[model samples]
Target: MSALQLQSAAGLLLLPALAWALGGFRRGVAPRVIATALALQLGLAAALLNIPPLRAAFALIGDGVNALATATKAGTALVFGYLGGAPLPFEEPFPGASFILFFQALPLVLVVGALSAVLYHWGVLPAIVRGMARLLRALLGLGGATGFGVAANVFVGMVEAPLMIRAWLARLTRSELFVVMTAGLATISGNTLVVYALVIAPVVPDAAGQLLTASLVSAPAAILAALLMIPPAPGEAATEGEEGIPTGLYDSSMDALVRGTQDGLGLLLGIMASLIVFVAIVALVNLALEPLTGLTLQKVMGWALWPVAWAMGVPAAEAATVGASLGVKMVVNEFVSYLDLARSGGAGLSDRSRLILTYALCGFTNLGSVGIMVGGMTAMCPERRHDIVRLGLPALVSGTIACCMTGAVVGVLTPP
Candidate 1:
C-alpha cells in the first residue's frame, strides 16, 4: 500500500488512542472487545463499498429511500393538494431552483416514524432488533439491556431507543450508562436518515446505505470510545433485560398511524424551531467573524475539525473544508451539516474527502441533543438523572470520536 493508503487504515486507531489517553490508560477487558468491533465494522464497510455483490445489494438502500420519498409525496399530494405538489412554472427562475425543504422533504420523517411503529407493532422490527442485540451482546460482552438499547438506536433514534430497556437503566453502572448515551449519539435514527437522504440525493449515491453503514459502524465505534474513556469496573455491568420491549402502544394500525404522525409533527416543529434559532445565531456569528477573519461560521467550524479530517487521510488541502462539516455535525446537528455539504458538493474535494465527510458527519452528537438524551434517559429512570449529567460530556466526546472512527474506515476502504 502507498503511504497515504497505509495512513488511512492506521488512522482508524487515532480515536481509540485518544480515548485511551482520555481514560488515563484505564485497565479493563475493553481493548479486545473494542478492537474486534472496529475490525468488524471496517470489514463490513469495505465490503459494502467495494465488493461487487455486497455493493450491489447495499445500493438498494438509495433506491429504497428514493421510492420512499416518492411514495410519501404521493400521499402528501392526495391529502395536501398543491401545497405538497410539484412546483409551478416560474416566469423567471432563480439560478438555483428553490423549494421548501420542510414541506417537500421533512414530511418523510412522519412516514418513516409511522411505518416503523407499524412494523414494530407487527413484530417485524422487534425480531430484527432482538437478533441484532444478541449478536452485539455476544460480540461485545455487553449486558442484555445495554446491547438492546444500542441495537435499537439503529431504528428509533437516541431518544426512543432507551425506552426499550428503561426498566434496567437505573441498575446500570456509571460506565455502562456512558455506553448508552455514547451509542445513542453515535448513530442517526431511521427517520432522520430519510430526511437526510432526501436532502443529499443530489450529491451522493446510495445515500441511505452510507448513512445506515455509518450508524452500524459507529455503534461499536462508540462502544470502543466508551470502553476506553470509562471502562467498566469489576462488577460493573448493565442489568439484564427484565422485560421485552414495550409493544401495542397503539391499539390498531390506525392508532399507530395517529401516534406516529403526532410524534412526527412534534419533531417537525422542533426541527423548524431549532433551525430558526441556530441559523440566526450563526448568521450573527458570521457577521462579527467576517470582519476579523474573513470567514463565516461554517468556515470556522471547518477549521476546528481540520485535524480530524487530516488524521483520516483526507487530502491536506481539503481537510479544513471537510472538517467544517464535522464541526457543524458536532456543534449544530447533522441535518444542517448535510445541507451545508450538499450546497458545496465536490467543492474541490476529492472522492476520498467526500467519502470521509459522509461517514464523519452521520450522527446525532450536536450540543442540542444532550438535553434530549438526558431528558429521555431521565424520564425512563429518573434516579439516574444525576449520573446522566455527570457522564454527559464523556458520552458526547465518545460519540464524536466514534463517527470519526467510522470515517477513518471509509477513508481506508478501497472503493470498487
Candidate 2:
C-alpha cells in the first residue's frame, strides 16, 4: 500500500479516537455498541466500494438519479425558458452567462421531492427505509424509532426524517436523539443530492453514485460517533416504543405529488434565503478580517483544518485547499464549499483529493443546519427543547467526524 493509503487507514481509526476523547460521558461509553458500529461501518464501506457487483449496482442507481436532474431541465425550460438552459433568442456578450441556479438547478428539488413523495405514498420508499431500519436495529441494537429516523434521513431532510417519528421524539433517550441528529447532519437528503451532484459534476466522476454511497456509508459512522459521545445508560436504550415506522398520510398519488411539490417549494425558498444571508455574512466578515489579520475566513479555517484534511489521506500540497473547502462546509454550508470545489476543479486538486472531499463535504453540518435541527426538534417536542439544544453542538461534532470517516474509507479503498 502507498503512504497516502496507509494514512487514510490511520484516519479511519484516529477519527473515532477523537470522538471518544471528546465524549462528554467517557465512563458511560459502551464498548460493545462502539465496536459493533465500527465493524458495521468498515464492513459496509468495503462491500459497497470493493466488491465489483455492488459497485456496478450503485453506479447504475446513481446514473438513474443523475438522469432525474436532466429530466428536471425539461420542466424547468418549459417554465423558465432560456434562463433554464433553453437556447437564448440572441447571443450574449459572455457564454454560460444565461445560466441561472434559481431557474435551472433549484427546480430539481421539486421533481425529486415530488417523486420521493409519490414513491413513499405508494409504499416503495417506506418499504426500503423500513428494511434498512430493521437491519440497523438488528446489527447496532438501536431503538426502533432511532433506527427509523436514521434510515429515513438517507432519503429525507433532517426535519423530515424526524417527522416519521415526531410523536416519539419526546420519548427518545438522549443517545438516540444524538444519533438522529448526527445522522441528519452526516447524510444528504435525496431531494437535494441532485443539486450537490450537479455542483461537483465537473470534477468528480460518477458524482451522483458517490454522493449516494457517501450518504449510505456515513450513517454507521454517525451512529458510532454518537454512541461514543453519549452512550445510553443501562435500561435507557429502548425508551421509545417498538411500533416501528408509521404509515404515510398521503391520500393518493396525486395528493402526494401536490404536497411534495409544496414542500419542495418551501425548501427552495429556504435555501435561497439562507444562501443570500450566509454569503453576505461571510463576505462582510472576510472584508473586515482581511484588513486586520491579512487573512480571510476560509484561509484561517484552512490553517486550522489542514492537519485534519492531511490526516484523511489528502496529499500535503492539496490538504490546505481541501481543508478550506471543509471549513466552508462547517461554517457556511456544503453548497458553497461544493461551489468552491467546482471552481477549483483540476487546476488546484488531484482526482483522489476531489473524491475524498466529495464524501467529506457531502453533509449538512454547517452552523445554519444546527439552528434548523434545534428549531425543528423544538417544534416537534417542545418539552424536549432543552435536551435538543444541549445536544446540538455535540451532534455537529459527531456528524462532522462521521463525514471525515467516510472520506478516509474512500481514500483507503481507492487506488492511488
Candidate 3:
C-alpha cells in the first residue's frame, strides 16, 4: 500500500478507539488500553497479511466462495429446468444441480438453529460460551453473563445470543445492555453467511470465507469498542447459571431435518422480500434526488463516504465507489450493498479496494437493523426496553466503527 493508504488505514483502525474515547473512556488508563489493543490488532493483521505463510493459511479455508457459487448455479439450474433445456451437449452433471446449492447454503440457517438447540441440550454451547467469556472477562473486565452473551454472538444470531443469557437481561446494567446491542450490530449471524456469500461471491474473490472472517473479527472489536464507550460500572456482576438447551424439542434427527427445512424456507422468503423492498426504496429515493442534486443518491453517498473509504485504505480513485457501498450498507442494508458490489464489475475499484470493501460491508449496521435488534431484544426482555431505546444510537455508531476496524485491518494487509 502507498503511504497515504497506510495512513488512512491506520486512522480508520483507530476510529473505534476514538469513538470510545469520545463517548466515555476519557480516563488516562482507559485511553492507553484502547490504544494498545488497537495497535496490537493492527499489527497482527499486518503481520498476517505480509507473512506469506499466514496469508497462505488464511487462503486454505478451502475457497468457500467458489463452492458457494457452484452451489448457487446448480440450484438455479435445477429449479428452472435449464439444465436440459439449455444448448449444452451433455446431460446435466448433477440431476438436481440448482437445488443442491440452495440446499447447501440456505438450509444452513435451519441447521444452525436446530444444531444450536442440540448443542444447548448437550452443554456444548455453554462450554464454548464459557471459554469466550473467560477471554472477555480478562481483557475487558466484563461481567460473566454479559461476556457470555457477547461471546455467544460469535456463533448465534443476534436474537438467539441473548436467549442464552435471557435470564439476566432484565437485570443487566446499562453498560452491559449497550455491549449486547453493539455486539449484535457489529456481527453477522452464521446462518446468513451463505446468503451473503451468494450475494457477493461473483464480485469478491473468496467472498464467503472473507465475509465470514470479517464477521468473526468484528465480534471482538465490537465488544472492545462497546467496553470503551461505556466502561463497566462498579457493581456486582451477573453470574452464569444453568442455561442448558432444550433436549426434547425434536423427536429425532429426521424431525430436526424437517423442522430445519421449514424454518429455512421462512428465512429465505423473508430475505428475498426484504431485499426487494429495500432496493426498490433506494431506487425511488435516487429518482427523487437525481433531479434536485444533479446526481443520483448513490453518487452522493459515494462522495460522502469517500474519505472514510480512503481512510480504510481503498485506493484514492476507488474510494468514492467503495464509500458509496458502505453508505448503502449503513443507510440501506448490507445485503443491498453486497448485491451492488457484486454487480459493479469493479468500477473505480482495484483488487485491493474490492477486498477492503468486502470487509467493510460485512455487518448489520443499516437503519433496518437498529429496529430489528431493539425490537428483538426488547421482546426478549421487556423490562430493558428503555435501555435499548437509549443505547440504540451509540450501538449503531459503535457497530459501524467495529466494522471499519475490520476494513482497516484488511486494508493494511492487502497490497496495493
Candidate 4:
C-alpha cells in the first residue's frame, strides 16, 4: 500500500479512541475501560484486515450486495407488473429480471420482523442478547440490561429494541440511557437491510450482505464507544426483567408470513416517501446554494469531509468523493447517501473507497434520526425526555464514530 493508504489505515484505526476522547473519557473509570476497549478493537482490526481469507470474505460480501440488488429489482418488477405499466427495455436479462428486486427488498423488513417475533417466542434472541450482555458487562462495565438492549438493536428496530427491556426504561440511569440511544443510532433494523442493500447494490454490486454485517458489527462498536463516552457509575447494572419474546397474534407460519408481507408493504411506502421528500429537500438546498457560494452540498461535502474519508482509509484521490458521501450520510439520511453513492456516476471510486462508503453509510445517525429517536424513545418512556434530550448529541457522535470505525476496519482488511 502507498504511504497515504497506510496513514488512512492508521487514522481509521484510531477513530474509536478519538471518539472516546471527544466524548469525555479523560476522567474516572471510563478512561481505563475505554482505553482497553480501543486497544482490543485496534488489535482486532489489524488481525482481521491482514488475513487473506477474511479479505476474500469481505469481497464476497460485495458480490452478495449485487445479488441482493438483482433479487430486489426482480421482486419490484413483479409487483409493478400488476400495475400495468409498459416494461422498460433493458440491455441485459438480469437488469430486466431484477426489477422485482426493488419490491421484494421491502419484504426483508417484514421478514426480519417476523423472524424476530419467532426468535423472541422461541427464546433464541434473548439467549443471544444475554450472551452479548455478559461480554459487554465484563469488557466495558456496562449494565446487563443496557448490554442486552444494545445487542438487541442489531436484529430489531430502535424503538422496538428498547421494548425488550421496557420494564427497566423508567429506572435507567443517564449513562445507561446514553448507551441505549447510541446503540439505536449505530444499528439499523434487520428489516431495512434489503432496502438499503438494494439502494447501493447497483454501485457497489453485491454489497448487501456486507452492509448487513457492517450494521451488525457496528452495534457492538457503538455500545463500546458509548460506554467510553460515559462509563457506568461505580455500582450500576442494567435492571433485569423476565426474559422472553412476545408472541404476536399469529397462529401459523402462513399467517405470520401474510402479516409480514403487509407490514413490509407499509414500511416500503414509508421508505419511499422518506426518500422522496429527503432528496427533494437536498435538491432545493443545492439550488439555493448554487448562487451564493457556487458550491452545492455535494461540493461542500467533498471539501469538508475529505479528511474524514481519508482517515477512514479511502484513497487520497477519492477521499473528497468519499468525504462527500460521508457528509451526506451525516447531514441527510444513509438512504439518501447510498443512492448518491450508487448513482453519482462521477468517475467510479476505487473498490476500497466503495467498501468504506458502504460501511460509513450503514447507520441511522443523521439530524432527522435524532428527532425520530428522541420522539420514539420519549414516547416509550415519557418520564425521561430530559435525559433523552441530553444524550442525543453524544449518541449521534458516538454512533457516527462507530460507523467510521467499521469503515476503517473494513478498509484495513480489504485487499488493495
Q: Which candidate is the best by lDDT?
A: 2
**Candidate 3 overall lDDT versus native:** 0.70
On a 0 to 1 TM-score scale, where does candidate 3 land against the true structure?
Answer: 0.82
Q: Give the per-residue lDDT of model 2 (tens digit) for 1-416.
A: 89999999899889988887888547665677777777777687778777899779867866786688789888888888888878789988785578787888888888888888899899998888888888888888888889989999998999999888998898898888999999999999997888888877878877887888899989989988888878777766574544656675788899999999999999998888888889899999999999998999999889888888987899999999888889998888999888877766756878888889999998899999999989998998999889999999989999999999899988888767
Per-candidate Cα lDDT values, in order, are 0.81, 0.86, 0.70, 0.70
Each prediction's TM-score versus the true structure:
0.94, 0.96, 0.82, 0.82
Clashes of each: 1, 0, 6, 29
Candidate 2 structure lDDT: 0.86
lDDT of 1 at 303: 83
The alpha-carbon lDDT assigned to residue 308 of candidate 4 equals 74
Clashing pairs in 1: 302-324
Q: What's the candidate order when arranged by decreasing lDDT?
A: 2, 1, 4, 3
Q: Residues 1-416, candidate 3, lDDT per residue (tens digit)?
A: 67756765676656765776767654323555566556655665666556787667655543554454455456444654544122345566774343333334454455445554555555576687778777767665567778777777876667777876788888787777888888888888766766777666567765666766787677667876777787665654544442442236567666765675576566666666666777789889988988887887778878987777877877677778887888889877887777677667667778877888788787788777787778788898888888888888889888888888788877766667
Q: Candidate 4, overall lDDT?
A: 0.70
Candidate 1 lDDT (Cα, whole model)?
A: 0.81
- Ten consecutive residues with minimal summed lDDT in candidate 3? 95-104
Candidate 4 lDDT tens digits, 1-416: 76655765687657766766886654445556656655555555555455678657767765654555455445555666622222555444664354343344554555555555565555576677778777767777666677778878877767777877777888888778888888888888766765677666566655656666676668667866776678666766555542433445467666665765676666667667766677788889999999988998978977887777878888778888888877777777887777667667435687777877788788887777777778888888889988888888878888888888777767766667
On TM-score, the leading prediction is: 2
Per-residue error at 327 for model 2, in Å?
Answer: 0.5
